[model samples]
Target chain A: MAESRGMFFKSAVVASYALMLAPVVMVIIISFFRQEIISFPPEGLTMQWYVNAWERREFARGFVTSLQVAAIATAIGVPLGTAAAYALARAKLPGREAISTLLLGPLAVPGVVAGTALYMFYLRAETWLDQDITATLSGLVAAHVLLTIPWTVRLVTASLQGMDRSAEEAAANLGARPPTVFMRVTLPMLRPGVVAAALFSFIQSFENLELTLLLVGPGRTTLPVAMLSYLEFRMDPTLAAVATVQILLVTAMMLITDRFVRLSRVI
Target chain B: MAALVLPAALLVFTLLVAPMALLARISLNHYSPTELMVEAFTAENYIRAVADPYYQQVLATTLGVAFLCTVLTVLLGFPAAYWLARMESNRKSIATILTLLPLLVGNVVRSAGWMALLGNEGGINAALRALHLTSGPLQLLYTPGAVIVGITAVVLPYMVLTLAAVIESIPRQAEEAAANLGATASTVFRRVVLPLSLPGVAAGSVLVFILCMNAYATPLLLGGPQFKMMAPAVYDQFVRGNNWPFGAALAFILLVATLVLTVIGSMALSRRYRG
Candidate 1:
């Protein structure tokens, strides 16, 4: 009975892992298929689709646009988030719970709901300002910053909670000013947490689709939005190729994240 | 401290809270074709959403699919979490990478894979025909089942990761102590291990439930036109149908439903384990 139970759980784990990975493996394999349509057991193998996917201007533009947007969003979000995390973690601010809750509110919200609500807000804001921000990269960045900040604050705050505060106090005892202690000691200690937060914020911003879809205008689509539109119009190995590149990028990002801070610690 | 927190607070208030508040307010407004939205207050949109049978079905389907996905994820994910939590650090690192890779990939790409694998001329059909299980292709894609499968696959990593984090925090000494006290392995797992892991299960369930409830992309791509869930229906109302009030109502409805159910679920699960 003991052996049987062990076997049962072992097989269950293996099956679950296989199920989790099968789709990704299939997409990669499909990318190599020569056929125009998607089917298992390809008629032949070819690299032509990858070539075609590379040559497509929209995919390239979308890739660059997503990169720019994710970068800008992360840039804007990190400082604000880190500052807020520091305040919440170290300082005894009034209404701390409320502030923390508000900061972390985006994590609870559905991206589609948040995206739609923001689209409406932007529409009204445009009416007041008499300028279009909605479909532009700036609008996309702003929305992404909202999505990314919570991750930074949450991760950084958690790390701060685990950190030893004696180091900061020791620097203070040595006549180091507050700013000097923060810059030299506190910031260095928070490096792993901050880096992990930045990585997560970047990846989340890059993979964002629902929020980007509503705000994205004609000719200014993010990569996921572009891939979605591509799939809507056609079914080909080009998408398979595009997805392969995405998988590769995400893999590299995750690997880098692992090197700096383990995934188990962060997520 | 005030300066540090103010920028983020202002951003959240202006961008996040204000918009959601406005969305709620607008859901009570009147819709107009020529003017987009009229300031006149009315509950007509909410009434329409509640009264319409189609909308009712959509809400039901949305709730049903989310519930199913949450349940399935927890069931499949618990063992995976167990495996990861018990593994040596070296093997645990590798397993964690494999498990989280799906989360790193975009949802559209993963759903697209499902579309290929579950379609009429897809992989399953090819294999079935080869085995002579059936003559023609099965209608697997564009169904509620496909959405469930796709969403489950997408969210499983989340459930597993959440549970693993919690389960790993559980000290092995407790289980060892239970075993040394003459409890059988299964009994220890049942009375001690399972009860202790309830918090993780509760948390993972809530996270997965909320995600599955407000799902947009997987349902759109996999479930297709025939099956309309709340999110896609809200999209249709706002974008295609041009009814901002109705869409706003649906969005709030989804948000409320998700929040209420998640709170209730976590409470219920935690309560169960507390006793």
Candidate 2:
């Protein structure tokens, strides 16, 4: 009886694995479906949806926009976050907990609420500055920068906690200047954390939708927003093809990330 | 060194704090079709939102759904979490990667995947028919149940990852000891594994519950427009209705409720499981 019950438990775990992978696996399979209506038996397989998704102007445009925004946001946010992380870990600054909480507060706020508030504030900013800001690329990049910062802080902080600071202390004791010690010693030691931070920062900014949804105006949609808009108008396999492409992209990066850093540690 | 923190502080302040402050102020003003918003100091938006039966039901439904999904994710998350925690080979890395894959896919994309699977003409219905399980396609999509399923799928990765981390810390010796004392399998689990894992359960539940409470994409995609949840309702008021004051009020209400309930739930869990 115990043996049978153990088998039952094992099967339940296997079944849970099925539940986790089923949808995305289904999505990958659906991408090749020849039928647009998505009926039973899946009609036949074709790569036409991939071609169609590729040819769509919105998706092409959205891909470039998402890339640029995610890149810029990561570049800008990661350095700032790394600096902040270092300062928090070593600076002995007052109200360290408070500062850390303030920096990470956006993670706690609902993305939609943040998006709506940012949109409204952009409107206020536009009128005050007498310039268009809400619908502009800069506005979107700013919003995505908020997305990037938290991931950078968290990953870098985790890596920092594990870091042996003795190298930095040795370099300092040997009479190296602060900048030299930081540049030559501190940075090389933080390579894994920095790389991991950049990877996740880019991923977070790239995959973000709810925060970017309202802020994205006409002709400035991110890939996820483009997919959402496409979803609103149609329910076809083209989206599956597009999603498969995304899954491939994210998985590739994650594999590359794991080559250098175990995400389980810092994640 | 503290000055190094200025750049990030300024960015967060500009983007999040200032905007939230603006939103709060706007929430106190009155909405006008003509002017978009007219400046006034009033609690009328909050009053109206609280007084409305429709908004109240939306809150209730959102709460009920969040609670239900939180419970489901914890229960379903345990067995997989245990497996993930206890695996003893290179395949453990593969399993971990597989678990992380869904999380890397955004909620919107995952919801789209779930949509295809749960639709009337989709895989589940197709299988049901092939098995002669039903005469017609079941009403799976565009239901509260569908939203719950999608939301659970979205947050389950987090719960699994969280529980697995905590469970990995627990020694196998406890379970072995219990079994050595002639305890039944169920008793060993009940007396050892379950109690030891309660903190993981509590943390994962609180985290998943918050994610569920503030969920926008899964609810919007799976529940269709007819079903109202707090996050989507806030979106509708602002985006579709152009009612900024009311939208801001709703947003604050959602935030407060999420925070309060999370605190209460975690406290209750820890208090009950002090053993």
True contacts kept of each: 0.61, 0.61
What is the lDDT for B231 in model 2? 89
Compared with the true structure, all predictions reach lDDT values of 0.88, 0.88
State the lDDT of candidate 2 residue by residue for B227-251, as single tens digits: 9899889988878899999999999
Residue pairs whose backbone atoms clash in candidate 1:
none
lDDT of 1 at B137: 89
Candidate 1 Cα outliers beyond 4 Å, as residue runs: none
TM-scores for candidates 1 onward, in order: 0.97, 0.97
TM-score of chain A of each: 0.96, 0.95
Model 1 Cα displacement at A53 (Å)? 1.6
**Alpha-carbon lDDT of model 1:** 0.88
lDDT of 1 at B264: 87
A213-242: candidate 2 lDDT, tens digit per residue: 888888888999898877765567989998
